[model samples]
Target: MSKVLIAYFSASGVTKNLAEKIAKENDYDIFEIVPQEIYTPADLDWTDKNSRSTKEMNDKSFRPPIVESTDVSGYDTVVIGFPVWWYTAPSIINTFIESVDLSGKTINAFCTSGGSGIDKCVNDLAATYPDLNFAKGLRLTGAESSEKIKEWISE
Candidate 1:
């Protein structure tokens, strides 16, 4: 088993692609944070106020259900990846974080976004889960080189 784990939630496959690249480049284990109800394009429409994603993001306390639980016990570090929703991580990330015991693990965050940085999302998560050790956050655009990933992870 690898000491590092790359876990991510990808609604549009962008984040998933980046996560897979990171994991493969580093030879780390990977886990997908699947939602119980897969999101359709309509559900993801941010312009629609009543869309599933909009409604969920409107309620900060809402935690969209995940398909399955994950085991983080064996990994010393966990890299979480997600897309920026409402300028932060999707609520399913909250559900995933709560569902797993990440105590003592070095939690790093990465996100795929068209025009958002990873700082706010990482800060939000660190504030919410003060007990977890959140190390670094990177905003990826799916065009990163292997050396860039190695440099980020090494930091």
Candidate 2:
């Protein structure tokens, strides 16, 4: 059996729950991609144009600093989970991706969103890091079943 790593960044605990379920169901190691400066509830207020998330999302080149790095030496498969922010993965995901060498690893991207799908997020990641293998990305909710995650991983 190949070693799998479920690495995720959760802003509001939605993606965290999904990642935990996927990890427990697949018996995989899990890592949380925490930011150096933790986001406050006010920072996450999307409706306010002056909010941190809003400003960060507006800048395409901004890569938020991560608190720690996870060594990806032994993992062959990685599942990256996050919340959909402005129809894409948070800038922190870029920081995490660039921190690791995932050239030949199979990457499955997933996100928890209220109504958006994962197509744009996946495409953006693929364009940003051409060498990494990004498999089909999934849009999930907290209510998703382990069997569903298993099937998605298998795909």
Best by lDDT: 1
Candidate 2 structure quality by residue, lDDT tens digits, 20-70? 888987799999999999999999999999999999999989999999989
Clashing pairs in 1: none
Lowest lDDT 10-residue stretch of candidate 2: 141-150
Residue 67 miss distance in model 2 (angstroms): 0.8
Q: What is the overall TM-score of model 1 with all chains considered together?
A: 0.96
lDDT values for all models = 0.93, 0.92
Candidate 1: C-alpha lDDT? 0.93
Question: Which parts of model 2 have CA positions greater than 4 angstroms off?
Answer: none
Task: Kindly give the number of clashing pairs for every candidate.
Answer: 0, 0
Q: 136 in model 2: Cα distance from truth in Å?
A: 0.4
